[model samples]
Target chain A: MKLSDIFKKKNSGDVAKDRLKMVLVSDRSSCSPEIMDRIKNDIIEVLSKYAEIDQDGLDIKITEMETDDKGTKSVPALYANIPIRNMHHTAK
Target chain B: MGEVIVITSGKGGVGKTTTTANVGTGLSMLNKKVVLVDTDIGLRNLDVVLGLENRIVYNLVDIVEGNCKLKQAMIKNKDNDNLYLIAAAQQRDKTSVTPEQMKKLTQELKAEFDYVIIDCPAGIEQGFKNAIAGADRAIIVTTPEVSAVRDADRIIGLLEADEMKQTQLVVNRLRPDMVKRGDMMSADDVVDVLRVDLLGIVPDDEDVVVATNRGEPLVGDSKSLAGQAYMNVCRRITGEQVPFLDLEAKKGLFGTIASVFKKK
Candidate 1:
């Protein structure tokens, strides 16, 4: 490797893209991760009372939705893929 | 029928008026009949930018209020017989004209002209709604800044919500020197964030200020880089596929060393 290659700089364009990506992720979600985290905790808390929910394999993520409607629409949608290990055995 | 295009920017002072004037004139120079509409009521500038401020008699409000005919209110360009202007009302605000009225007026103009380019006011409000009401397409102008790009993203969202199917972006005032130094955002940076189809990239040039102040669009000035850029945008708009302009800054000894390694 040449000595000049060692001093090669990270372009500002790359820096700008990195910064914008973080900002846009939050902007599109319209909420901070902390807020979403609290909401997720509350959901699990409430669900545990009704039935036992698998605590270890819970997945909740806020992401964009793609539509098949005629007019183009891009929006954030909450997707939760939770695995229920087993339901609480109830007594009749 | 004519195609109605509105040149807009969510934030102010990003060259919406300048882009409208140049693109309108550029299209007219290509033998396409174009009418430049100044929808920025109460703060009109397209006339001033186009150097037709002194010719305003019956304005947009006058035509909408039935006080004057559309042709009587339209001002013909001295440089190009095909170009015209419909100055906005300076005394009243944006509320004077409704979207329905704007739509009707645009339809009328479409029958007579090949293109009706509306110069939209900054901000997404009554002025913006009214501007796009008559527009079949939109051209968003933005500078290479975080604030400008953020506002542009919001605007693209709003436009998408409005079901505007045709929209493009034009990046303005890009300084090649600053871009080379990594001190400012480049065209690619803006495009990566905006995620809109690239329309044109106008280089930052001082000749634009002089030409704008003189009420002469730089599109006619062959020597001006900004003018040539606008001309290229015009050709692309007319269904001609033109490659983007090369605004790359010349590199020095250090840049040469880094570039040689970059290829490897």
Candidate 2:
């Protein structure tokens, strides 16, 4: 079978493959996506407890991107970004 | 210098104990003073595999409890005078021994022997934790099945978490014919998933079963194919880059000719 035929995104099986990749990444990193979501939620809760923070401006995301190697594909490393508001918020 | 190695797999029945017994015997055959420790506690079988089960008067728990000295618990291998075994307490579970005790025992063994191989129990619980606490390196055994590979990967992750530096893979019970027919995963396929250095591959040999049933490890049996593979792994462990054994069936001339034409 051709590689393209096996890996096409619209093949429906590709969804399962992607899910497996996500799961394997989480396993390799020793951090679960479920736990990461809980952590983000708790951070948001703590921010709300202190003051009114703009929820729309809050951005929490975790991503994995592979770096192109010299004629070889490399393993993807995890990246997480969580934006927090500064103490000096403009007074309403 | 003595090195402490642990053989472990997160899944059961992946030949962890068999690997430990054979490798220990192989190392001992090389004139290296080797000791095999069964950390499985209640599920202990290393002694049986080494044909020293009947000689174990004092178990590992006895040594840990101070009822007996470490020397008293060790059963010397009659076949290889340099090899010894510390049999686990079949009556007691893993909690009976702590990681501290294992560390102290391995430390003392290090002073006396050249290699200390521990057969870790299945799972990621206290037995696994205690087995790896004193290990300098690890050898993970897995079959060609997906479940075995997945569990081996989890065990590797745990070993990494403990900061166990060196880890190698031993693909056991591999059938090369099945791999060629796509009925089973190839050694290379499993290696890609685990991403670990390949140590050795043991074929699905019936001699292994006969040896195990006779309470003798395959290491000393010249006719056993698995025995030769275990010896090769022992040489590799001793810093020798021995060529991997050709356990797979040789392709026919037709297949070879086809491959040559495809390359053209």
Candidate 3:
């Protein structure tokens, strides 16, 4: 009831919303947090061989893409964009 | 012709059958001819919940297999003259009846009744698919628990994928005391989390258990708040804009302040 209570409290509602957001995001994408982490590591591993990749800037996610189709496509495509600052120039 | 609405919840034991009985009974109380179909197959409970189990001779499977006529299989409720129920076959599983058969059965019922409410089983399996096959509208029921809400969100996504456009939610067994104590999710929090249009919210009531045990739908009892909530949902289904029940307001802001001060 008090204004001070609002700022200090992370109500169960807020906790529920935040948790649902995390889980639903993973559910919709069909990519579990574990799988995403693995994919992130694998991608960085492959990219490290060719260039000094930006591991900190690596982002991998799966989301719905608008295809000229009716339904929210069952298999949403994976979207991964890794930022590359510069390639390692070695013995070239 | 009538609208075939599916009363579904991806997770079990969240009062889907109870909601179906009350909502169907509620609609019938409003003078609408409503028939509830239990498509849960082997795990049949709607008929029992409606107190119509002893009356079912022919079930959904029989109707689909031509063993019984659609009219013959329908069991008219003893409580409401206009309300009816088509019991699911206890001997069969979800695989026995196909979605096409369900669609056909619903279509036939639609021609005869003002509303066809299908009681969908838990999980997004064959039974779930069959239940929603012919439904033009959906009412996804869920509790405030994290697991229930997660399943509800999945059901919403699946319904969207199935192109069942008019999907609404019914948040059941809401505890106001828990919400005020920051121990449970509020109705608004659930709405924002699931991203679905609100159908109704039923406050947590022990009377629901009593009503279920007695096979009497709470919707008929004017004394029950949950009954009032179901009647409101019925009004909404009939295209009347009924406002949601203020579940929180029952224990007003003053009560919260009093409780807060009592800590001293």
Predicted candidate 1 versus true structure: per-residue lDDT over B83-164, tens digit per residue = 9999999999999999999999999999999999999999999999999998888899999887788778888888887888
List residue ranges in candidate 1 displaced over 4 A.
A1-15, A32-92, B249-264
Query: For model 1, what is the error of residue B147's alpha carbon versus the real structure, in angstroms, after optimal superposition?
Result: 0.8
**The best candidate in terms of TM-score:** 3
Whichever of 1 and 2 has more TM-score, that candidate is: 1
The digit string of per-residue lDDT tens for model 2 on B1-264 reads 699999999999989999999999899988999999999989988887878878989988999899988888889997789899999999899899999999998999998999999999999999999999899999999997766777898998788879898999999998766666556777887787677999999888899998999888898566766888888989999999999877663334446776899999
- Candidate 2 C-alpha lDDT tens digits along A1-92: 68777555343323433444455666766777787778777877776665565667665544445566552334545353435465434432
Q: Write one digit per residue (lDDT tens) for candidate 3, span A1-92.
A: 58768745877666777778778779887778998899889988888877887788887777657676775344677788889877877715
What TM-score would you give candidate 2 relative to the actual structure? 0.76
All candidates in order of TM-score, best leading: 3, 1, 2
Candidate 3 lDDT over residue span B1-264, tens digit each: 889999999999999999999999999999999999999999999987888878989999999899988889989899578998999999989999999988888898899899999999999999999999999999999999899999998999899889996999999999887898887888888997776889899988878999989888889576777988989988998999988877778767757798899998
Between candidates 1 and 3, name the one with more favorable TM-score.
Answer: 3
DockQ of each: 0.34, 0.09, 0.52
Clashing pairs in 3: none
Superposed model 2: Cα runs more than 4 Å off:
A1-23, A29-92, B250-264
Clashing pairs in 2: none
